[model samples]
Target: MNEAIMEKVSADPFAKLLGIQIIEIEEGKAIVSLNIKENMLNFHGAVNGGVIFSLADVAFAIASNSYGQTAVGIHVTINYMKAGMFKDTLTATAEEVSKNPKLGLYRMTIRNQDGELLATADGMVYRKKEQFA
Candidate 1:
């Protein structure tokens, strides 16, 4: 199941475009990493909040869909706590907070290589009856 989930996430074009890498994934958790690049920086010369949010979203998507059922994000809220610098490797981890037959809630955290918290997010997804192909 993990292998299949990894394969599915590996093919995500948006994730690939942002250089997000899947570090780990299980039934209701996932870890993804990204290396800060020049293009990812904002006018303030810090990694853009969108980039951090994208990393967290990737982790959330992976964890929510880890069950092999199609899950689509319905809502998400993120809080940025720190800035990421160039060359910094950021990792985002998502874990299931709660779930039922049709909905799932996940909590995600982004941290730098030194384990400093960068951002946190909560996401909810609606599970579909269809399974991944």
Candidate 2:
């Protein structure tokens, strides 16, 4: 991992606030994790959907920008498949599906520590001309 790139990803305030950990990053993939806390629960006691979405989004962002180019999410769709419980550790893995000069597509999957799938997402990003790393 490049220290500069890792530093940039780790410096995101929302990720920090949610205790998200950037586990891995490559040219077109990323893995992120989050330990669900009681405070992160929804009214029904399951982890909030937004939290799961954010985790997937972080992985998507890291993967899309892993090329050192500035990539911004243009479209994303997620489907929740399972409820996440408090105290559970969830992992999100993002993989690049396709890309062109100015755009990229990624797929992200969220799973529990036990390997049960929780959610899946498809994401698209618009790559900017500027490089961040």
Candidate 3:
């Protein structure tokens, strides 16, 4: 099940476009990483907030849908604590906070290669009855 979910998430076009990779994934948990590229930086020379948010969102999506149920993010809030620089690797890990039949809550932390916290996010998803199969 985990393998299938990983494969499914790996095939995400947006993730592929941003070079996001799934480092690890299991039921209710996922870790993803991305290397900060020049194109990913903002005018201030730091990684764009949207890029960081997308990395976190990918982790959340993988964790929330690990159970094979189709889940879509309904709401999310993120806080940026530090900036990511070029050539730095950013990793985001997501863990389920709570889940029911209809909804799931998740928390995500984004860190740099040095383990410095860069951002955090809380997300809610609406789980559909349909399966990923």
Candidate 4:
């Protein structure tokens, strides 16, 4: 992945707030992790759903743009399967599900340190016209 793109993403407020890291970026996938902190919890002390969603969203952003050809997210359907508690690291891995000349479908999972799934998402990305594939 491009260093400039990584810089632009890491500068986002929510990413900085949650302390998310872009662990790996490859041709068609991206993995991001967040080390949960005390401030990330809600009134009940459970990690907020928005935080999990953000992690997945960022993963999608990086994955969609990983090819060095810009793309935009058309939609994403996210599901919260479990609550993340305690201070722990959460990882999200997004992979391309399908692709055509113009559209790509991707899915990602947010997992706890133990590899237990906390959330899942399916995203649609629209690739722009460019000489690069």
Candidate 5:
């Protein structure tokens, strides 16, 4: 793991606000975790889909930008496989599938502590010339 990249991603305010923790990061991969909270639940009592998507998005963002380049999400699609309850620990792992100078593709999976699949997402990012230090 590069300390510079880790430090940059660690400073994200939205991730901080959601209590998302970055467990690991590599050139094209990242793992992040979050513990479900009461406020994150939807009216039906399950963890909100937006929260799950945000957790996965954070992983995707970190991995895509791990090279120190500025990367912005261009397209994303997610499928919810199961419901998450309060206190459930969710982890989202994102891996780079392919990339070029200007574009990158990634796949992310969200799972519960019990190792059950909660959601899967596919994302695309537009790699920019600017860099992150």
Candidate 6:
């Protein structure tokens, strides 16, 4: 499903225009990254919060689907610990904190290339039964 999701997301003309990429997927975790460019900067010349949030969300989407089942986010709360700088390849990793038969909890950290913590995110996702189940 990761490959399928990536294809669907990348097939979008707008995302293609923005050059977004889904980098890697691992066990109960995902690594997503994008370089901060001029268009992504806010008024103060820092990376926009929406961009950071989207990256974190992408990581969550991949990690929550880690167990070979579908999952959908029920809640997501993000704390902006620090401002993200421009021109850096912002990376976010989402790790599953806990899970049950019907629920999953995840925490994600957004960091700059040098490993400075930019934002912290937590989300609660509900696991869905597989279509083939």
Highest lDDT scorer: 5
**Distance (Å) between predicted and true CA of 17, model 6?**
5.6
Misplaced by over 4 Å in model 2 are none
User: Residues 17-128, candidate 3, lDDT per residue (tens digit)?
Assistant: 9999889988999999999999999999999999999999999999999998999999999999999999999999999999999999999999999999999999999999
- What candidate 4 gets wrong by more than 4 Å, as runs, is 1-13, 130-133
In order, candidate lDDTs are: 0.95, 0.95, 0.95, 0.85, 0.97, 0.81
In candidate 6, how many Å is residue 69 off? 1.3
Error of 5 at 49 (Å): 0.2
Q: Which lDDT tens digits does candidate 2 get at residues 1-133? A: 6777777887989999999998999999999999999999999999999999999999999999888889999999999999999999999999999999999999999999999999999999999999878
Which stretches of candidate 1 lie above 4 Å from their native place?
none
Assess the local accuracy of residue 99 in candidate 5 as a C-alpha lDDT between 0 and 100. 92
Error of 6 at 46 (Å): 1.0
How do the candidates rank by lDDT, highest first? 5, 2, 3, 1, 4, 6
By summed lDDT, the worst window of 10 consecutive residues in model 5 runs over: 1-10
The runs of at least 3 residues in candidate 5 whose Cα sits more than 4 Å from the true structure, single-residue gaps closed, are none
Candidate 5 lDDT at 10 equals: 97
Which residue pairs in candidate 1 collide?
none
lDDT of 5 at 26: 89
Per-model TM-score versus the true fold: 0.97, 0.97, 0.97, 0.86, 0.98, 0.84
Q: How close is candidate 1 to the true structure, as a TM-score?
A: 0.97
For residue 22, give model 5's deviation from the true position in Å.
Answer: 0.6
lDDT for model 2 comes to 0.95
- Candidate 2 versus the native: TM-score? 0.97
lDDT of 5 by residue, 77-113 (tens): 9999999999999999999999999999999999999
